[model samples]
Target: MITIEQYVGKWSENEDWTEVRQAYAAQLLIQVNKLLEAAKKAGIELKNNPNTDSLISGTQYGGFRPQSCPIGAAGSSHKQGQAVDIFDPQNKLDGWINDAILTQYGLYREHPDATIRWCHLSTRAPKSGRRTFLP
Candidate 1:
């Protein structure tokens, strides 16, 4: 099992995203590590080393830009450094994984009804509680 520190170290070593070594990135790294552990326990193989194409770089703070939607514009979460679009290796299993598993780790899929099919997960929570795009 990889510790969060180790995961963060590996992530920092990625030349493509070296800027993510900041404090905020470290926090996200810890959260992702926890998720990875849970996923491993559930027999799921998450692709941590996704291709560059799978990632959508954001202009705000190197977070991720959401695909354009009728509800709003792109790059919203980018500003807050709180959103990411995960690319699933198996398209068929993506929806189920996003809905059933990721939510347990403080992630929520956004804009399911939109044309683009990307899983949006964030650590952000509202005053009320954790929000879900589905139901």
Candidate 2:
């Protein structure tokens, strides 16, 4: 699991964004931690896997993408620090579409389409309690 300090923007290029990201860390930490826990419970190891590592680790993803980062959907939960895109390096958990554990942890997958493969979950509260998948 990653610490709040790991949730930073491009500090080297934009100090302002770094400050913003840090200030928002407290609000985001719990969510990120819960997400990580869910991943672990689902048997997804997010360590040094080539496809599942962080950008700082020389991979496209892992967790905590800042608003300044030029990837993912614009105005995404990722930018708000409430979401993470998990790369299932070992194809574990048979995909997160039907995982009851995720719901038990109060995490929701952003995409409902199983073909997307990777687990994209968020801590953002939904508009209605009837649904857990985002549009």
Candidate 3:
């Protein structure tokens, strides 16, 4: 499981998103942790946050991005603290996960094509209402 600090990125590049992310950390943890547990149950190892003390060591996007981050849209769910992009170096999680697994966790994911080496998940519903949606 990812700590709130790692999830929120303690030393953010902008520093402005730290406090804002902290405000959403607790609630985000409740949602993201469930999915992490689900992944573990599915035999997936989400040990992406190896550097517990680092600023942006959470994932490829490095969790809780500020507006300045170049990864997602300005209005993306990540900015709202409603989404997380887990580090799946070998694409195992993305390839293995199915609709049933997503429904079991009450979470949704971006299409595997867009995800590549990372898996983008969110508790927020997509406009298409799909378990695996296109961004």
Task: Name the best candidate (by TM-score).
Answer: 3
Best model per lDDT: 3
Kindly list the per-residue Cα lDDT of model 2 for residues 47-103, writing each as its tens digit: 544543441232543355645567767666666656555554443532543546656
lDDT of 3 at 59: 40
Model 1, 49-69: lDDT tens digits are: 233422222222224322332
TM-score of 1: 0.49
Cα error of candidate 3 at position 88, Å: 0.2
Tell me the number of clashing residue pairs for each predicted model.
0, 0, 0
In model 2, which runs have C-alpha deviations exceeding 4 angstroms?
9-29, 38-47, 51-58, 66-70, 93-99, 112-117, 126-135
- Global lDDT of model 1: 0.44
Pairs that clash in candidate 2: none
Q: CA shift at 9, candidate 1, in angstroms?
A: 15
The candidate 1 region of ten consecutive residues with least summed lDDT is 53-62
lDDT of 1 at 4: 29
Error of 1 at 49 (Å): 6.1
| Model 3 ranges with Cα > 4 A deviation | 11-24, 49-60
